[model samples]
Target: MKNTSQSETISIIGAGLVGSLLAVLLAKRGYQVEVYERRPDMRKNTISAGRSINLALANRGIYPLQQAGLMEKVTPILTAMKGRMVHDLEGKQNFQSYGQKVEEVIYSVSRGQLNKICMDAAEETGLVNIHFNQKCESVNFIDKTMTLTDELSNESRQVTFEHIIGTDGSTSAVRDAIHQVNSSQHDIIPLGHSYKELRIPPGKNGEFLIDKNALHIWPRGGYMLIALPNEDASFTVTLFMPNQGEISFENFDTPEKVKDFFKRYFSNVVPLIPDLSQDFFNNPTGKLATIKCSPWHYQDKALILGDAAHAVVPFHGQGMNCGFEDALNLVETIDKYPNDWQTIFSEVEKNRKINGDAIADMAIENYITMRDSVRDEKFLLRNALAFELENRFPDYFCPRYSMVMFHRLPYAEAKSRGSIQEEILMQLTDSARALDDINYSIAEKLIKQKLSRVQLNPN
Candidate 1:
């Protein structure tokens, strides 16, 4: 093997957020990084425009950006959101703070903007080259060669590299190639839920139509509509519903039906969204799913990260955050074994497989909680009690949502602790009328006994 210190030429498939950030990270470590994107560069041309998924940037995701020294520039684009602003069927609104303190809030950021920032950061390193309009058509992982197609000209080119990283997202072409080689261990599980995007335009004078600092949700029994504020004073609205069934996306045959459905269920939103009909008809509906793949790396030649390895439903708003964590985790693993690709790949797969699956499952569970449980009185009580416990026992208790969102806790740990915390909440709140009804003595005793202290290491 060549000296571990020798510069390794790394081919990165997909120039999206994860791929771009990985490029910056590796390039800073003196690796020659080649990044390829299938689409026209959004930094130059318009891409995804209105249909882009606006991201919820939390602590886990922010830590990675800070590590890359990109937060100094990226933080300016973020809009702080401290909690959920739930609007009822009657249009009555309520605020639910995400955390007890002032700094415990997520930021709303445009996905395209964040991607462009990472891409720019990578290119500025001079060691990274981002080839726009170049798509990875297929890969010969055995020989470590890849065929890249020019999307604009439909021309193909082949490149050889000892190492390849696939962050091309859930529908990854490189991953497909890996699947062709070994199909037994790779699977994409579909979530029955699908989502459609709508926009709530800014009011006159660029004023926000609703509260500007919170994530707004309209939770019905079976499905829900959520709106996250954007920097341009507009809000990105998403409707999550089943693909089939009476109350699903399949049932809304016409724009009129959609409007009527909205008027009946989300009546207040009718006036708030003036272009609701046009948007309902014009915008595309997207499917939600999770990808489960074992051995994320193939013999040290190729590896997959982010949505490619484990795509989760976006209910918990951790899909991007988890992907960011993947980048950080891999970077740390690489630091541990700077020159050993085989060891790096194996350790990454070992370290992340369970955490990835755990977050995916938790994201799915959160979908139900967001759409149905958010409005439930029992759910509210449990949430309140959970927050109370966190307030009382800062070291021993952290609400599952807070742990996942506010702290850098591992997803598997959060999910495990969350399950226990959830059971305790169910037991205490199952019959209690409200917070006053729950016995603090028994609750604190159970928490201290069942849950260990959450030690947050300083970053």
Candidate 2:
């Protein structure tokens, strides 16, 4: 690692979660950082409703907070979710533990609150300056200049920088500029699904209306409704369904239709959210997409990170965590190759692109698993067997979900091993209906033959 230096000034675009955290990390390295965000300062202004998704902070994300020395402040706002609480139409509930150990849990965090905390941390660094409502109109890589337009006044200003990093988001001006110069391929693949954010307010006397420790999911094969707990004893609930299907957001146009739809599907949840119809009609429906692009940097003059570079769907709840990982990796790479911006940017993209793509694919796959497969007894059986295998073969086998959530294993590595584990599970559970009926001898043999011993140091 290189020693901190104050000579370099880094201009970062966007003051969202990743950008704010990146500002803190860069400032800690003694770099003079300036951040420009298109949105108004959320702390001073009320955030726009319905667009915010509850973030699932896992080990990958928490490590960066720890590295930035902000975990102490972040912990209080986090609500630990140990498992998925699947609610059936009949109101029967099934809890699926995420992992074996107590520490193997993900956190439910409000995006707005977390972003505010990160911004506060960045400002506390004193070396970072964040300018809000300043939208980047364009970037001139040739001259190392960026044009920022004041959102309020529609006035534009030219800014010069030593180095520029864009955490702007999916629709990024920096990314558009980079693509103009470098002939790179990019695609925004829509999931054909949209989501509406609703709220489950607290009970009387500020009491939690439901279980506060688990992420609640009402899965209907073609669509799903998920709720994450908040510190205020309320829950941030999201409903994801197709945009124009027989049973979709398009189908429920009126308040009566919305109430009837909820009563038909998420019947148990209708009572918890008193103004369900109002929330459904009032909250805007947000689109879901996976944004992919290559050559994320432009000759070291500029680079983009987080959602600007790779935006995945939120099914796996790794969007924020993955972006945080990108920030962490970029800063670490800079430390490793100080003064070599080309190498730093190249290494950052090389290290993250494949992993980002892997997680993207996995996120889509998880959407199906969450919405459809969770109802399968076979899926539950495999999940249980995965835990047993990890316990039995400790070093050789770890479930893919566990590896992704709890361990520092590369996302690509986890996906690969998960495929092998899935095959093993299928073979082992071929004839068996439950864990008791499964033959241990075949499982041990298959695991030993298929998986190599791994050193897992989970966070």
Candidate 3:
């Protein structure tokens, strides 16, 4: 057996955000790190399909970047978003705070740029090696080897390493190899919804036409549209709609039809998107899915992280955040159980799977909330009451959204707590609505009792 003190070679598949970050962290700790990526260097690329350059980086992702010492390097490139600006069909807007104040801003960053930063940081480490355009063809856990084929040359090569990490993403090749060897059970459930990206370029003289400090949302009962700021003073808009069977763009292909649909449904956003009809015709449709699996690691020889292990919908904006957290958690585990590869891998699998499942479920539920429930009169009333309650009892009656997005609570715990909070708020709202019909004193007592049971002290 090799001595525990000796340096070990670690191979990481996929040079995406998580893989590159993990490579840098491992290399800094004196391990030999090799990263294999199937795509060409993004820095030199002119065009790439199916890649959305912009994403929202909330507190969940920011904390990990700060710990990795890359937050400062990337912060200057981000645009701060303080809240959501909701647009009504009549060209009116309403502001909803995401946090306590204006200074608490989530960042809007370019995903490609962030990936480049991580890749460059990993390369700067003398112990790290990167092979772009090298695709992993197969992996033999019994032999501790991976077969790679050069995409350009069509030549195959073999590499051996002590440990392997997979961050290859939702359609991960490394994940498939691991499943093949371990006979793991996995499922990918596709939501019936599909999305398409549109753009609202800066107005004349390179000025933004809308507020850059807020994420813009236009919810229309059965579907929703959202826009986030870009560094170029533009906005990247996305429209989430039902797939083939439900509402679609087939009948609204012509410019006249598109304009009429926008006029009736999204009058405010229609004017902002100048090339609306062209964008609708040119943009490719994207599918949404949730990936679920158990036992993320296999016998210390191979492991998976990020979207490869669990891919959630983006409604909660936690996909990248959770992936970044996965890297931090794995590194922390490695630090605690140094040189004990098997135990460390086993523990990671157990802990991450539990949290991943929790977040996936939350993300799915958030989709429903965003698409249909956002405009519900009853739900809005409940939200207003909850916020009012928070003002009255700041410590005890925080809203569920505030806790889940603003606090560092565990994903599973947040979901459970949020469910409880919702029940109490619903009862309170119902009682308030029927105040004139029922006995006022009795209703007040019942509301207080429910609040007390949930630890909410509404003074």
Candidate 4:
């Protein structure tokens, strides 16, 4: 099935979501592909319990799945999360819609299920071969070779390739090799916050304890706890806080302190989890970070995609979506320049690098919005006003969140326009509590003057 006239084949590292998806995408293009995964076959083994077992899939990710002809396979495993259901300290709940329309909602998906489906699809093509428990040891772009150590046999094998793509996640061995060659190429910046996972099982009748259609959050100033529903009527709960602070993970060392901490802030959640203290102490605490690297491709010999190139925090729910977009972008770019590897790599890297950085920065900003601003009165007012402005100036105005989640607008463009939108909102909300008190004439005039317009979206 190899389309190229040359003898060289494409090799991929990491069989996680991005790796499997990339392998399928490349195989579909008639390139013989082989993948190496560090972990055991996830389909046959139970996934390790850790933070963020599920992922939020938005339009950016869906576009790629649709491209791979996987939406039908993936749709059944997904549960729609229309918006953020914010819970107050007293257990009061409020729903905030994520998008303007019904069809604009994001989805909650299990990581293990999605990875298995992708790998299955790749292998079903018969153009891809995946070797499990083969840990990537090193990648030599100069020699066009990659050495993978067999976990079972403790043997190393060097595989040669005409081209290589590293879709390995954060702590990527492929990326580490690139760093060794070029020390100043990348930096992994920690966000100083960590997260721990807690589970909320379903009721006796298999009913969801909370509204299953929404992503739930308990936003405290500087810290928060979030939950997303799973198919089994259960929820995967996560507690995010500073690594070292007045009321951080450090302070929740003892069982008594963990109990009291949940009682103080997540009082309503304490009763939902029978083994709160046990889960809190037993589960691992995971760190959040952004991996910013340059020159995604090492000449034409090797390239890095997904988390290997840019790893953003999960605050905006775009981490997986962005990585999926990377896979789609590279495949399409390669399609355009099939015979020219350098051009394909350069074009993809040039186009995706800014968007990658843009999403990373936006994810950090959204963490602040999620933890503190979601519950603020002014923040709510501005959020409502942003939608109002979008209603009036539909072409010119779209909330940054909507742009990032619901629309295909480039992330860099969204971030740039969002800064301008923020200034306008600040001026319009100056000393005003609600939209009724504002001057519509002045608002319309200022919007027209400062913001350009196009044909409105009928939807």
Each candidate structure's TM-score, on Cα atoms with residue i matched to residue i, is 0.96, 0.98, 0.90, 0.96
Instruction: State in Å the error of residue 195, model 3.
Output: 0.9
Instruction: Quote the positional error of residue 364 for candidate 1 in Å.
Output: 0.9
Best by TM-score: 2
Question: Model 3's lDDT to the true fold?
Answer: 0.79
Looking at model 2, residue 107 earns an lDDT score of 97
Worst 10 residues of 2 by lDDT: 46-55
Q: List where candidate 1 sits over 4 angstroms from the true fold.
A: 1-6, 49-51, 457-459
Residues 1-459 of candidate 4: C-alpha lDDT, one tens digit per residue: 225423447889988889999988888878789898888888888867223789899988988898888989999999999999999999999999987888979999998889899999999989899999999999887877888899989999997878888888887887777667764468789999999999999998999999999999999988999999999999999999999978898877999999988899999999899889889988999999999998687667777889889999989998789889899988888767776888888898898999999999999999999988999888888888899988888878888888888877778888888888888888898888988877777778877787765322211
Q: What are the clashing pairs of model 3? A: none
Lowest-sum lDDT 10-residue window in model 3: 450-459
lDDT of 4: 0.87
Kindly give the stretch of ten consecutive residues in candidate 4 with the minimal lDDT sum.
Answer: 450-459
Candidate 2, residue 454: how far the Cα is off, in Å: 2.1
> Residue by residue across 1-459, what tens digits does model 2's lDDT show?
345468889999999889999999998888889999998988998876225656789998999999999999889999999999999999999999999999999999878888888899899989999999999999998788889999999999999988899999989899999999989999899999999989999999999988999989999999999999999999989999999978888888988888888899999999999988888888899999999899898887888999999999998888888999999998898888887999999899899999989999999999999999999999999999999999999989998898888987788888998999999999888888989999999899999998999756533
Q: Look at candidate 4 and give me any clashing residue pairs.
A: none
TM-score: model 3 vs. ground truth: 0.90
Question: What digit string (tens of lDDT, one per residue) describes model 3 on residues 1-459?
Answer: 112332788899999888988877676666788899998888788545235668888777777787678887889889988878888778688887776655456788888888889888888877788899999988888888899999999999988878999998999887888888776889999987878888999989898889998888888867888899999999999988877643564445577876787778888787789899888888887889999986688887888999999999888888888888888777778877887889888888887787788889999888777767766777767777666666655545667666556655567666776776687676666756532333435434544555443332111
